[model samples]
Target: MTTLTPAFFAQFDQDRLTAADQAHYMHGYHVFDEHREQGALNIAAAEGAYIYDTAGNRYLDAVGGMWCTNIGLGREEMAQAIADQVRQLAYSNPFSDMANVTAIELCEKLASLAPGDLDHVFLTTGGSTAVDTAYRLIQFYQNSRGKPAKKHVIARHGAYHGSTYLTMSIGNKAADRAPEFDFLRDKIHHVSCPHPYRAPEGMSEADFLDFLVAEFEDKILSLGAERVAAFFAEPIMGSGGVIIPPRGYHKRMWEVCQLHDVLYVSDEVVTSFGRLGKFFASEELFGVQPDIITTAKGLTSGYLPLGACIFSERIWQVIGEPGKGRCFTHGFTYSGHPVSCASALKNIEIIERENLLAHVEDVGAYLEQRLQTLAGLPLVGDVRCQRLMACVEFVADKRSKALFPEALNIGEKIHRRAQAKGLLVRPIVHLNVMSPALTITHAQVDEIVETLRSCILETAAELQRSGQYAGH
Candidate 1:
């Protein structure tokens, strides 16, 4: 009913975005309409470690946009690389003997960078596809080797592999899976999470590792080791609230897997591509080389969607059978998109040329040290972190190690408060997770920590007055 003036249209367009986006889009990992009702924080632009909303308000992005924007938002080099590729050849189907030069080069570069002889690469669109490919590859290898009964896979508790039915089924977090898509439940079994906070009291690191290994052995034995295909894990669990397992836990677990002749696959989707102060978190952190590694996110630095399932010669040779329709019989239409591969190659070049991995090692240590100071706070129970990724768990009583009830929404309060103060944070359960870009400066680290500290005080008072502070 209103006249369509230019100024009016601008404001109307901005205001109408909230309603329009809410009505059509069913956002991922979000409660959709419910969160939409709360008003989405629509990002307009971003650069370095900061993002500006449509309202022109700027915020320091600590969570790195679902933990994917590792190289930070809006890098000119990445943008140009994507543009150049789009001009030359934007799309290609790497199927039926057809391939793209960018894709081939990316595979070679990734092979050179990957730990050990993870020489072969099977590219995919994203993390879920990479995980699914790895699963299929495992099956293919086992079947080729005449282990027809080897169908079950072992996944660690509190891990997030992907959202696809198979990956979701094996993921440690059961809540991520849709209620109806529980078909793969029987094919996957979960082992104890290596997180120390959830670890039972009076258990040493040695005992914990032994307990987990024993559980893995028990589960495999119960299912018959011959039926077990592979053991899947994240070097450090990400969406499972940033849990870092005990030292040597993976080594011992790998030993058990080897004893059972089970293949090991590391889901380095979030932990690879130098995000964890190393090219691969599994080999760098746990000192265990996986037979297969699924990686994404930083592969293209989220500039373009690209993921890969890299495998050692053992698994590769078994699956690379010739003729008679012996192929793996799995692939996506956009499996090796030229543009995505171009972006990934350039991104990796930036990481290597800039020495970003070594920077993460130094800055990550500094961050861990600084972040640990939050532990002494009355509301903070423990700070679990390693190298650029961190989480602060809120407890009702630090001494007793009791968490605040979910109803309190302490993490949400802290997150919102931090966002208001120009710092972005994500809340999961009773913890605040920060996964800032690896390129963050020391000053930026200090600023992030300072803002978070202020947010805690502000949230505490607000929650206390509202009778939501669960601290007794």
Candidate 2:
């Protein structure tokens, strides 16, 4: 993990590149010692639904470039759009009232696509900043409206907001809120995850829904209606093991938030831009309109860094009142970077041109159906999916819903095997996740399922032989 280099850097040599990566390239949350000898996976090139390593091995990218590549990869038109924008107007100051053409255009496009009166957009570098900005905007809104006491925020257990201090503080994930790292402990609260699969064994789905709604209302009242500002949630929790909430969960939670004057902030970083067969999932899929929607990832299809904190007209009337001489006093150097905005504009155009939204509805269903086949496997505890996004939870005992020991690194093992067998999946704890490009074909879906099946079976056999997994 040395950050110092002695001599001149070599860019072309593979071994030299690996050495440089080990010496200085710092990646997030990676086990440095574990990959100290072998180095990292060197991604060299990417095409539609596939990525190639430095050594030229190809993988059907099942994780969609970390759940962002909705339009797939290596689109020449996307490249042309980016290049054209760069050549036309590469950079501009998004400070104060100054703006660029692409930035203005992208905002208008996003406003049109987003549901409800989410007409105002605050652009950011990525999802993390979008969320961070949204919270700050909430703070501004609360303070301006003369309710400074309504500062505390409510997020759910097992939520992933961002790596920023405030976002991490509110997010209850263990790694984000680790003991060593500092987080705002007092400003955040958590409710139970709305996971139907992990709900009380005897509780029916309807009862579970009622219980969640009651619990959410109870959390708000317990915090005091005047003290809570907002409830932050993902439509389907993405990083917390792709936990899809119970039916009617989003609408009910929004209702409760509405009753208590708490704003609903939907974190649709992974769900927006065609991951769930909709441009946005909150209103269209779940029937709830959030006050603030934090979005990124698929915004530019992972091509350029871009994200937005889209706010409703109701919020704008308070904080954006022109007559009041209001100053929101928040922004970034690359808040509305012209090149990034141009890329996003092109990405949306491509999605429309290809009719990715309709295609996702058709193919996403097929993917969910195909993944159901994995439930028959012994290692699988649950096969949960929300349209194209999916996860396979590993288990030691199927009937009892027992998890395998963490030491086994079961998800990583399966991920490595699947990658070798020509598909890539995301490994989060004991869960193997998939979120392929929206352009993925039926054949690609079949390839993913079959490769995963073989990989899981092989992994099980190897674990059994090593006495790590008991067949009984």
Candidate 3:
């Protein structure tokens, strides 16, 4: 409704193009009715930490292009690398004994970088496929190990793995539920989310930690350890409100998985590639070396569609065993596509050569600190974050920490307000999630925080004027 007149859109008949878009191109996870009425922002271009809408609006992309774009945008080097690979070999059949150099090199680098002995890499199209592949690999491994009954998988209630059928089943997020879509509920189970802030009213952090671990173990037992095959988790629960679980939660859960002989799959689609100032947060921040790590997004820095399912030596010894005549018949056609592998290699090169990880370590802490200063604001109930990844949960009553009614669309209100003032954040229910580029400077972090502060304040004023909020 702001009206778009971007240079690119000018070349075409704007009304006709807009009509074409509305008639076709159904978007993902979008409300079609609302979209048809409000239209869309044509993100024309991007550079560094900011994106330009067709309406000539430049906003700092605090969502980091949906939790990817680690090395930031419009990198000529990335473009060159991808183009070079395309001219050389665009597609590589990964079936049978066929191989490609780029993918092979990528595998070697990934193995060297991955924690522990997670050396085997199964490349896929995106995070969903990568996680789906991991699930299938778990099924194949458990069955090959003669434990055909171990088909059950355990995941946390708020955790998000992916959108694929198998990954959706493992992910117990609100969107991945029954009625709307069928899932493998009989084979997959969920325990409570390990969010400290949302723990029972009287439960202390220590008590919450104990409860989570005990509940996890109890869930495994309830499913019968012999029937439980694996447990899936995101290190920081990215889509589930940027949740940083209680201290020592991952390690304790890993211990439980070890005791029950259940494999731990760390889904690092959003956490890896410098988002947390580490390649992977499983072992560095959480003290757990998972048997498998499903990663994408920043693997190629979102320059290309690529995902990898990293497997440990223990499982590979079973799945990759010689001459069993049992073909691990699960694979994707685009697995290890030469261009994606090349992009990932170059992305890793840029991350290392520029020392973006170290940069993130310094500036990420600064961003979190600046964001925490917003806790005094009227609508802010919680400012939970880890390094560059963050979430600001809003509430009608800060004292009681009571959420605004879902119909109020508090997150969307703040998001629109911020976008109008040159900032962008992902609206997840009642929270606004942020994951800026690793290249963002400390000054930019200050700008993001200050602009966001004004947005929240402005929205609170509007809501109060309308009698929707009783200020804290």
lDDT of 1 by residue, 1-472 (tens): 2232444334535677887778776777777545766967887667888887766678998898777787877887788888999999988878878999999998998899888989999999999999999998888888898988998998987779988877887786744654655556678888888888877888887787788889889999999998999999988888888988877888888898989998889999989877788888788678898999999988887777889999998776676656636766789999989999998888888888899999999988888988887777668878987888899988777667887777777788788888888999888878899888889988988988888888877777776788766554
Q: Estimate each model's TM-score.
A: 0.95, 0.96, 0.97
Q: Per-prediction count of colliding residue pairs?
A: 0, 0, 0
| lDDT of predicted model 2 | 0.89
lDDT of 2 at 76: 88
Ranking by TM-score: 3, 2, 1
Encode model 3's per-residue lDDT on 102-192: one tens digit a residue. 9999999999999999989998889999899989899999989999999899999988888877777788888446466888768888999
Evaluate residue 140 in candidate 2 and report its C-alpha lDDT on the 0 to 100 scale. 95
Name the candidate, 1 or 2, with the larger lDDT value.
2
Clashes, model 2? 0
Candidate 2 displacement at residue 95 in angstroms: 0.8
Whole-model lDDT per candidate: 0.84, 0.89, 0.90
Candidate 3 shows a clash count of: 0
Worst 10 residues of 3 by lDDT: 1-10
